[model samples]
Target: MDREQHVHTIDTPKARIQAPAFACDSHIHIYDRRFAASPGNGAHIVDRATVEDYRRVQERTGTQRTVIVTPRPYGTDNCVTVDAIRQLGIDNARGVAVLRPDVSDTELDMLDRGGIRGIRFTLYTPHQAVVTFDMVEPLARRIAELGWHVQLHWTADQIVEHEALLTRLPCKMVFDHLARLPPPVGTSHPAYGVVRRLAASGRVWVKLSGAYLDSQVGLAGGYADLAETTRAWAALLPQRTVWGSDWPHVTETHKPDTAAIFDLLGTWVEDEAARKRILVDNPAELYGFAR
Candidate 1:
């Protein structure tokens, strides 16, 4: 693992920290127009972020494993993410899909066989979310039988507001983008307490990615302002945390430097072992990747 290895990325330079062998980028999205959005898809932009493009992202970040999350624009159509996993090789990639409550048992089994490891709820924007919050509990119950977790992309207020409903979910939880914590440092937010309580109870996982999404500073001073959010979670639950690239960032007017983005974990947790736990071990266990 050469620390100075020359790896290419879409908008950023090569990651300064050399990722350990079996390192995994636990969150990303693959969008291909050929897959076609489902009827449930809301009014949203569709982009061509194919599986081939993510291969270069893997190279740039020095990661060999990935967890491809079905983006909201596709609604309940998880074919794009599933296709990406197949193309990337199931041994190296897994998926977190979005599903309607009426999804049949056969469909769930098929997704399980195809390497889908979890279900995602994108509730941050209620107006655009096809799979609404009420659908979460029932789907979470269904997915739990398959040993899959429920990943959420909820706003800070949403998390606090739904604490009761969330607490009752049968499956484990992984919150996306630092659990979408309120910006300018997330510790003060009430959602922080909710996540911390859930995390302490052993049913929660938080991803230390997508700082630019909430940061008002906007990658200022190398995302220094976002460090508090990252460190707060990393320090609180090292085992229940993972890192991601959130590749082909669709919502952003300016895409982030994923390599530089990956390097921030290096700064947050100087311990090589701790970083490996977040980048390798925890995701392998959570996503059921082979050890």
Candidate 2:
């Protein structure tokens, strides 16, 4: 089987959604086989999705800015993501890297200069993490000095459990995948309230990404079940919200059409200005894009 076939194809019907200028896809991963998977990383690494391949996605989604994240496959070796940032150009790209607690200040500085704006703690993946929840507060303290934030991918319950720690972190917080909260429980979940309150603190941001991950209604419905929750967050915290396609849709049994994902944003954020805030202004401030 061709490895390239495993990556998502951009063939959805023309999206009703159109992105505003400087629209940013705030979450994505680039998997290059040259970057060896970490030991004990049980996660299945996918085919190489290079900078150019993602540009095709940009063409389809009409998003010019992106945040290239280092997935668990690369462990703490962020060569592929750092390289992608450089190729995509510092002005249009930012990155979220994964690093060990013992990483040197010199190395951190180098990554900071390489367009990395935050460190990720991906608790939702099957693989063992190089940085766990317990390490977040301490690491946030160190990165806070450099004006870097902490990005997290955790289950909804864990968000509630770690609410205090999240609030106490010295730097800003970004929650991936709508906080990964399940439906029916959805915003009624206790963690959702905590997340809302944290966003109120003016230091927390949430990515409108990974709709299928938490959708009880599944992909056939285009994850429409999440629309209400998505609208609540957008209306309540437009300035703190951003959109991401979760491109490659690696976790799903089947890949979702990226164009459809862009279209979904229209249902969630109907007001043109509010949609621009999620796609443009919020990401610009959170990721330090030049005006």
Candidate 3:
């Protein structure tokens, strides 16, 4: 396939806003045209989202720093994400990567030098690329040796079932998308209880991004409930929680409005002091973002 000939037209929502100076889009993905190549072999072929694509969105959204997460379509490849960090420069970027059990220490050190601070395990996809409990222990130990965290993308149910193995890890754990919790609009959900316990562990951090993925209220109503749930989680462990935009809303029928997404974050951290902590202080400390 001709990579240059296939230009992706991104239909971003038209909500405008002044970008916040200290604000960071904590979660994003970048696909390179060369390495990740065509979205062939059962991979979903979306337009290549390069560092340049992200820079454009950051300019419009006023996002100062970003966390480039390794996406599923790319499988365990970290080349695209690593290149993005190098091109964007470390002062403005960090990354989460995927790895196989056999990944060498030398390779991990190289990634660390390239601005990768975390590793991710996807537990919710049909791809079934879920990391086993056995994999978590040793992998967590290695990541701990590198001073990085493990980002878990599991459904709320899995989180509950895997509590023992997850908490046993030596490294820090970051739960993506409100820990993939069930929408708070329902009955006594196990996810909420699990999240509460995980937050109390002091080693776990949750990203208040991707609420749109779990909410039933589309964008408007969905975000409100998400904000409320996030607020509750933050209250449990204000210092351990952070915010992210989950930009580019890949594979979704309705893309999220980036501007409004940031605005909604304000609702999650209502108190002025707490808002500063979650949006600025906490993320800076967790990801080692340069001041």
Candidate 4:
């Protein structure tokens, strides 16, 4: 989509429930205008999602902190996300960056100083090359030295195939969008079993976000089963599970309604204690959110 087409102001719904202090939106993208001029192949251009925009969402949603994730459009140039963290102030935010395997230690140190806590490798989109097992080892070692985690976006089906490699990584592994599992199949699906087992490892964490992307029934029915699946995963690893809005919902023709996404969490984890862990405690611990 063109940058202009993605720039329209969206009316975010008022959060229906009060969010706890230290609450965090662990995943969102901030595209800058410069990325469009210097785009990568198959890149999806988007309007700049500035720090001001995030502040407004936080004000409305009671989100006290956020994790700015670098989008593919930026193509490993994490300037947009890094700049947003600096502009927003590091005390209230952290970031996940996209970096080439060969990025120097100096650059990685600079990123850590800029509030980056993780390195994300994408495997969901065909446009982005699939990351291999070989890549995982060295990358994991480097990130582990920095005390940063590795955030992976992959299809559920690929988990079993890559299980041994992923399990052996020295760094903490975060699975985005509940391992990007396909919905309508429910938690009983074999792939989710792999997710459960992965979570049981203590080193693997899962984001209870992006159900709309994986579900077959749009937002409504899609979220119900997705919540069921999340509950199962949460039961397996409550301390390791976290939640995020996946705000802006890029690429989808109809953007995911933000309020609807947050409200769905209530259904996913009905127990207040579990919800607290996913929304507050877990993120604070995983992302190293300063109290």
Candidate 5:
């Protein structure tokens, strides 16, 4: 079988939903321990999981393109993320890095040529993070000229407190894990309104991934607790949402069922064209992937 046409899944009955042509997993992490982890950033170390492993995930998920996020374990050292983009073929992969605000323009140019499309700050689980929240604006200003975005994984309350800072950043913003909103009051959360206002400005993209992240009801119910927030985002920002598997799931003690998580899109949007918007079109536009 031709490599690009390859389709495989980890499920016993096999995943019935295949991703559309050019569909992209807009967030993932590739860990290569051959490159040493930065000091105090070792909690996320998963042994030897590289691009080859992720390609199998792509096969399982039926996705052709992906965006590699610099995992928290690597801190500001983007080498692992950069190398994954090269290995996965830059045309089919892009990266979101973690960088210090003092990163030189030389290094910045190097990253741009290296297929990096954005930067991420993992404030949700902050511990020895090299970049602080205060550094966001300056770095946001720097990357804005490069057309790169600032991706955030802040908690809902953090979003509420940082409203002034969140609303005025110079570049585009991509929030992770359904904006980390708490359940039951999912869309009604104050942070959701802040995000909605931000989205209304046409500069925000939210990952329709990580259904298990904030679900009080847990995955056995197919993350039904997330349904309200998922549908609300789909209704409001179909053009701005993208999907991710959070592959390897280093943060979780139990791995999520990837096929089942991907299947959540079916629940989120029954309309296939809208699903394609999250799976294909929006990512191609956000990450500069060729359609």
Candidate 6:
């Protein structure tokens, strides 16, 4: 393998919006070269963004808690994520791991001790994925006993197609990037209705992250379309919504100002109480952070 190139920097302004006490970022990844990417995995480690690197993001955005997610590059090997959770300390951090159904209970117990609260199904893979749709239900059933949820990264159409499956999960569910809705159609897309329905189910949480990825207008335009979608989703399910920085902005052509993204939440949820619900209260409930 060749030397990996670094991705975006953590260059961001001091967040203008002051985060409430125990504010959680709720989504992030710490990619280390020590945990090599799977040979078959399409997503490679373009950077060595560590737990320390992401603390800079947290500092810039005034987020005190974080959810460390296992990136697709490492496939089902969750060592990087687990190590990060350990490094960040379980008291202020939780994690989502990419694991298969065959993982032993003992390993899961260790992961739980390391602050893992969910399993991620990276279904949007260009190549063969380690964890597939067929694996979700069985794994969900197993992790449900451990009180873990299923975190899914699916496109809007796939979310619609698997709505029943998502609803049937024994544990709670999280939809990444607000189902990665089509930028052109925004909430008008048929899948947006399905996502709303899922949110209404009270078992699903939509991550108000990744505005940079979902924006059709590019990063320079400040992801106006995504901001609109966030406002709509927040109005419909304030309790079910949580925000993330998606720090290091992997695979993105242009890196967004994370502080700007944090401030955008203030615009979406104008009321201070409602903003607290989205940023502090909701994440506390979802990730088991102390209230």
Q: What TM-score against the true fold does each predicted structure earn?
A: 0.93, 0.93, 0.87, 0.90, 0.93, 0.92
Model 6 scores a C-alpha lDDT of: 0.82
| lDDT (C-alpha) at residue 282 in model 4 | 91
Instruction: Flag regions of model 1 displaced more than 4 Å.
Output: 1-12, 39-48
**Per-residue alpha-carbon lDDT of candidate 1 for residues 1-291, written as tens digits (9 for 90 to 100):** 222122242444668999999999998888787877666555454444677767777778899999999876677878888888899999999999989899999999999999999998888887877778999999999999899999999998899999999899989999989887766747899999998888767989998888878877785567677788888898898898999988766666666667777888889888999999999899988999888
Which structure is stronger by TM-score: 1 or 6? 1
Report the candidate with higher lDDT, 2 versus 6.
Answer: 2
Per-residue accuracy of model 5 over 224-277 as CA lDDT, tens digit each: 999889888888898999988887666656666566677778877889999999
- Runs of candidate 3 exceeding 4 Å displacement: 1-20, 37-41, 130-133, 185-187, 220-222
C-alpha lDDT score of every prediction, in listed order? 0.84, 0.84, 0.75, 0.77, 0.84, 0.82
Model 4, span 75-100: residue lDDT tens: 77888888989887898789998776
Task: Give lDDT tens digits, candidate 3, residues 1-291.
Answer: 321222233554432544446776789888776675324425653663677766766655677888999877777778888888889888888999988678998999999999999999877763556355457678888889788999988888888888788767888899898887666652256867776676665788889888888887776474665666777778877888888877667755666656677777665665777867776778888899965
lDDT of 5: 0.84
Q: Number of clashes in every candidate structure?
A: 0, 0, 0, 0, 0, 0
The 10-residue segment of model 5 with minimum total lDDT is: 1-10
Candidate 2: residue 265 Cα off by (Å) = 0.1
Candidate 4 error regions (>4 Å): 1-12, 34-38, 130-133, 220-222
lDDT of 6 by residue, 1-291 (tens): 211122243332478989988899998889888788877766788564788777766777788889999988888888899888888888889999999878998999999988999999878752556778989999999999888899988888888888788778878898888678877788898888887777665787889988776677877777887777888778878898899988767767656667777888888778999988988899889888887
* lDDT of model 5 at position 125: 60
Winner of 1 and 2 under TM-score: 2
